[model samples]
Target: MSRLFPFHGGLKTVRHKTESNQQAIRPAPVPRRLVVPLRQHIGAIAKPLVQPGDRVLKGQMIGQAEGYISAAVHAPTSGVVTALDQRPVPHPSGLADWCVTVESDGEERWVERKPVDYHRLHPSELRNLLRNAGVVGLGGAAFPSAVKLNLSGHCDRLETLILNGAECEPWITCDDRLMRERAAGIVAGLHIIAHLLEPREVLIGIEDDKPEAIAAMTAACAGTGYQVRVVPTRYPSGSVKQLVKLLTGRETPVDGLPVDVGVQCFNVATAHTIHRAVDYGEPVISRVVTVTGQVRQPGNVEALLGTPFVELVELCGGYQDGVERLIMGGPMMGFALHGDEVPVTKATNCILAASAEQLTPDRPVMPCIRCGACVDVCPANLLPQQLYWHARAKEFDKAQDYHLFSCIECGCCSYVCPSRIPLVQYYRYAKNEIWAQEKEKQKAELARQRHQARLERLEREKQEREAKLRQKAPPRSEPAVAKPTLETAVARAKTSPAPTLETTAETVNRDG
Candidate 1:
């Protein structure tokens, strides 16, 4: 048995997973209109490839990946492009972004797919293929899988590869249901990942709360030298850093990634997508979503990308009477959505229609008692109290001094705080402020550089004009034959005036 290590400070929150994981994954009905956002993944938003009135087939690339860190966006079904304009998307900020709205043709026609023999292709080719296929982590991070798969500068060789099935948050069971039903496909995808990475060992981490998933994954991993390790049921264990610590006993650097610790982690859903993309030539047009809480039928659905949250809720028999808020992801880390009309993206894993009973009561804020409750439960082992104080004061540098970025926004501190303070919100605010300041700095620097370049260009042009004028100037003609002054002319005239008329007549006769 592989030795498992424990990490510091985690909460044993209520697992409301059974509400959604009890049934098999259902395929969601394609909506009449799908509003797919171009900014699904973490990096640059994808560039739109289709415009209004263009007909597109299912699995067609609708948005091309824009950068090395981005992923492509594909058509969820055969459709006609209706609008490529700014529309509401699923984000905590409640902002609109550029999206491709498609009206389904009801044909479900697919573009011709060319599945490749991954083993024969170069690693770069395979990664590019995955990028074009829109493969990204489905564990809510939605990081491009191609970027993670490339282990270029992180280490000499990968030591461990962890497939995260530890869907440890409350009321989210998309991953749990995926593992229970599609373990084989996931493992097959794992094989492709292993082929590319060639890690020394493979470990799948599932929370102990998910026995069926554990058993299913274990069975699928048999004979493949991959081990399914059931970690203790703890809040935020599904987090990459915490899961890495639990599985490998290695600490990821606060300023670095898991690969910096010679480990790489991928969501099991991501691996399954890899399998579909490589072996089956399918792009990531859909994902399994858990829709529960204040709904008539709480279950998991394989929802197409851009399917509205309202549609999924309706599919699950719509909302219950007392539905107070619509949240994306789980209660611990998820944010409440502005409305259910927002479209699902690659980052969406759960649609929680929370009621007053399901949500924490809106308790009045109280002064901190300095009881140290938050410190005791912080999984990252940071001083959350200090962070909160600094963040609330708008002392962003002080918050950074407290290692605020290391907090992971896991909400454990907020959960344990006696003051009922929304500590996470303050941290998020501070982080955003800091980011905005940095962007302003970058813009200032860029403008300064441009001004300097313009000045230099003007100076060069001025010098060139001076040089050209000098070259075009006429040369002096031997001092202009020394023109006589008035005095010299008068003196010369006095000496020769007596014979002037005679000389003039003689000169004229000689010339004639």
Candidate 2:
């Protein structure tokens, strides 16, 4: 048994996990229409590869990875591309994004798959393969897994690799069910990751609430030298930084990644996708999602990417009465959706249909009592009250001084606030404003650079034109004759002198 370390400032919230994890994972039926978003992963949005009216096979790359930090987007099922246009996507802002709307042909046909042996392939090739396969962290961060696998500048050698099985969010149990049902597959995927990183030690972190998942993972890790460490059931323990601290006693830098601490963490679901991608030659076309809260049937479903949330709700026997809000993730960190029409993306892990009873009541906002409750429960060890003040005051720089970005927006602070202040919302607002300001600054800087370049280009062109004129003109023959000046004219008049009258009389006589 590996010893566990504790992180500071976490909440012991109610775990509504049993409501969803009781049942086995079910495969969701393909929807009649699938709306796939291209910007599912963290970096540049995948570039569209197909146009309207194109027939695509299931798992075919519909959007190719755009950059080193991007993941590909694929067809969820064999379908005809009906439209490549804007559609509502699963986001907190409830904004629409570019999507590939496909009308399923009901064929469910897949493209050719060629699995490779990881042992024989180079790490770069393996990372590239996973990148093309669209494998990202299904832990809800949805960061491209391929980018995490590369340890180039992060560290000389990886010390620890942690598989985060601690689905610590309330009412989210996709990872729990996945661990219970597909532990071996997850282990298989971890093997590939371990091969790539060659970490000194491999550890799997699970919360104490999940005994069955811990046992299942332990059994699967037998003879593999991987240790499954069960942490205390704490909200936000599943977060990378906290989990890293819990499993390895390493403090990830506030502005750096786990790799900066000689550790790297990935969600267990991400590992499973790696297994599927490398061993089965399949891409990330689907994921297991927890449909819980105010739902008729609360369970986990292996939902296809681009499948509408409504279809998964239907699969779970639809919504129960008093379903007040439809959220795309756990109540703690998830954002409420505008509607269920939005398609599931790589980042989606749960569909929470929260009823009034399941949700925190909308109490009137009151002034802060300075109770220090929020400060006590902030998992990131931040002064929540100060952050709230700064954020609410729109003092963004002060919020950054309070390490605003370090706050994971896990909602622990808000959950404990005595004033019922939506502290997290304020932080989010501040962060968004900061991001918007940063983007504007970047745009302004880019424009300035372009304008400077244009001015330089014009100056260079002007110089080139002058040089050409100088070269094209004929050379002066004899340093062209000088015009007679005042002094020269006076001198010439004196020299030409009195050839006048006397000379003129002699000249006239000769003429006569």
Candidate 3:
């Protein structure tokens, strides 16, 4: 065992996780309808496979992966496609996105299933299978798992594989419950990851708060030689970069990934899904989600993908009186969802029906007190005040200079701010501005390239036409000019010799 490395700064926030983790995970009843978003994952949106009125079976792929970084979408249950149009999705912006609405028939018929013999299959084939099965990072990023497994140009062999069981975000107990109940399945998935990456060591990093999870995972890993390293309970400890640094002493390069540091990470629930997809031929149709905070019965539920958040709230005995906001994910890093109508996607881990007290109370912004509390609690060791200044002033370049992207939007700075500044929101604005500017720059560059290519093509065509004309033109033989001597003139000049200049001009014009 190696010594654990410490991250720069973190907080000891409230752990509202116990309430949700106390109950056994229950299966959420299949909803009558599912609104499946095609662009749930963080890459190219999956192309729709079925049309309206088409009958789909449970586990059938409703959408196919369109690009390497995209994940396929499966039918959560047998149903008929009702609509393939824009609908309000669970996003911070309250925007509508493309979704497939399926009305379930209550039959729950499944498509044929064939489990893979992964040991005998080629690595590429295995990856494609996982893609079709629609595996993604269940830890909110929703990045396709196949892309991480490929590890192209990142490393030769992985040094470590860290499993993130540190559900540090308050009120999110899905992973915690998953670890305690399905430790064996999780370890089985770890074996699959080990076989794929062939890492030298496998480490599972769980927060010290989850003793039961740690013990269960420990017993499960006894014969496998994998380690269960209990990390100190801290806010944002579940973050991939922070966890990697804590467990392996390697800081992932800014703008890079864990793989760049010779390491890779996957959420524990993600690993369990991999095990199920390969061993049981099950696609990612359902996932465990935490339904807590201001609900009548707070706990975890294994809900099918596309199950409406409203239904989950109902399953938990409906919302309590005076519930103010509904947030997806946890309160710390999560975003406030517009309504409960949004359907669960791969990224849906927790649904927080927050009361006004449980939610971060809106406060009037005062001038920065310059108390430096944000600096002390920042997990990324960044200057929150400087970032706030630049972002507030719209000086995005300055914010970038201060390493704005390094800030993980952990809400620590905002949490500690005396003036109640929403620092994370400002940082998000700056990053979005930068990304938009970059995208415009790319579009302009592409247009320039196209124009340059057109100009070069025109020049080449002009040269080719000139060469063809030169080939067609007759070779000059000095125009057979006879000497002006008397005998030569009498013999050669019998007929009126055409004007050499005129004839040449005519020939050139004709060729032209």
**Highest TM-score scorer:** 1
Can you tell me which runs of candidate 1 are displaced by over 4 Å? 463-512
Please write out the lDDT profile of model 1 over residues 1-512, one tens digit for every residue: 67888889999998888898899999999999999999999999999999899999999999999978999999999989999999999998899999999999999999999889999999999999999999999999899999999999999899999999999999999999999999999999999999999999999999999999999999999999999998989988999999999999999998999999999999999999999999999999999999999999999999999999999999999988999999999999999999889998999999999999778789999988889999999999999889988998899999999899998999998888888999999999999999999999999999999999999997986677556545443222222346646666566567656444554465467556
| Clash count, predicted structure 1 | 0
Model 2, residue 400: C-alpha shift (Å): 1.2
Computed on alpha carbons, the lDDT of every model, listed in order, comes to 0.92, 0.91, 0.91
Against the correct fold, how does model 1 do in TM-score?
0.92
Q: What's model 1's lDDT at 269?
A: 97
TM-score of each: 0.92, 0.91, 0.89
Residue lDDT tens for model 3, 1-512: 56899898899999998778899999999899999999889999999999999999999999999967899999999989999999988889989998999999999999999998889988889889999999999999899999999976999889999999998999999998999999999999988888899899999999999999999999999989899999988999999999999999999887898999899999999999999999999999999999999999999999999899999999999999999999999898999988899999999999999898886677788899889999999888899999999999999999999999999999999988889889999999999999999999999999999999999997986687566655543322223453345665555446545445555575478567
Candidate 3 residue spans exceeding 4 A from truth: 449-512
Model 2, range 98-212, lDDT digits (tens) per residue? 9999999998999998889999999999999999999999999899999999999989999999999999999999999999999999999999999999999999999999999
Which window of 10 residues has the lowest lDDT sum in candidate 2? 471-480
Q: How close is candidate 2 to the true structure, as a TM-score?
A: 0.91
Clash count for candidate 2 is 0
